[model samples]
Target: MANIPLEDIQNDVDTIVSEWIDLGLLKRGELFVIGCSTSEVAGERIGTSGNKQIAKELFTSFRKLEEKTGVSLAFQCCEHLNRALVVSEDVLERFRLTEVSAIPVPGAGGSMAAYAFQQMQDAVLVESIQAHAGMDIGDTFIGMHLKPVVVPIRLRQKNIGAAHVTFARTRPKLIGGERAVYSKDQAKSMLCD
Candidate 1:
């Protein structure tokens, strides 16, 4: 496998996060989940070649994103931990999430998640969360952590290092059938009592 420069990894993350910011879907303080596989980023199969240095670069970019957007972050662990997430204690209390017991290691939780658990001031593991938005780097599968009615976001920057990337934003489910008026203008025209 080819060696992916750490600088490239950081640049890709920054670019992707910038696109996410431009979308304007994620609000301040909203939960954003991230699922990444450092091994995949390094041009290897997921869980085969975990790299701490790659995780560090990705983590740095994500921290910058948090500072710029004020969005809370959740780092999803690998399937070994049943895809639980690493989040700050504040996020846990704010969302009333149930705490889970585990300390993520590179082999078990994944390099990205394990790094996040260590860097966070008060990191805690949670069984689950319904995040408002999310990015999946290296096909780690963040869908289970996102809220219902997820809208896939297509970004110009599609890859982080050697891994494919996907993004999503959640919105309230549109209910009602044909009779439903979705906009204020339509409601005014209908004039229902």
Candidate 2:
């Protein structure tokens, strides 16, 4: 957008992440995935135009989230790279994810992912991951990186710039019949069953 305010975009990110923290959907020592399309944010077709300014705004917000929550962030690349992700080596080691070799540029990986890769400490390309929660900016389709049992979240700030936003968090899959009770009190019984 010609008049896109970086603060507003950053605020949108802050609000969604705050909601996740408030709901306990995201916690410390977890992974958060982000899929952003800077072109869509600028009111252009996806992948046609990548904006580093927009990416910088979004990435800064994500960094704030990480600093506050102690959660790791992963950036998902565009389809040119088959939507592979960039994450810190610590996250790779923790999750046992396989590392791939490739340097992301704006054309291939999209602006946001490429910017994130540059910003991350010990960044590495990974084939896949099972994140605990995530945000999809501009319909970038981040769901593929989230853990199974994703529950969609509706946030107050539904869009960042012109891009549609989607938020989600994962939970442990429920695997029992009608007779099964699911609660903290039943945790031991379920685990011992």
In terms of TM-score, the best-performing candidate is 1
In model 2, the worst 10-residue window by lDDT is 17-26
What lDDT score is found at residue 17 in candidate 1?
81
lDDT of each: 0.93, 0.87
What would the TM-scores of all predictions be?
0.95, 0.91
Local accuracy of candidate 2 as per-residue lDDT tens digits, 68-160: 788899999999998999999998999999999897899999999899888876999999999999989889898889899999888787888
C-alpha RMSD for every candidate: 1.7, 2.7
Give the best candidate by lDDT: 1
Report the lDDT tens digits of candidate 1 across residue range 1-193.
5587888888899899888778777789999999999998999999999899999998988987788899999999999999999999999999999999999999999999999999999999999999999999899999999999999989999999999999998998999999777889878777865
- Which residue runs does candidate 1 get wrong by more than 4 Å? 184-193
Which residue pairs show backbone clashes in model 2? none
lDDT of 1: 0.93
- What lDDT score goes with residue 132 in model 2? 91
| Model 2 TM | 0.91
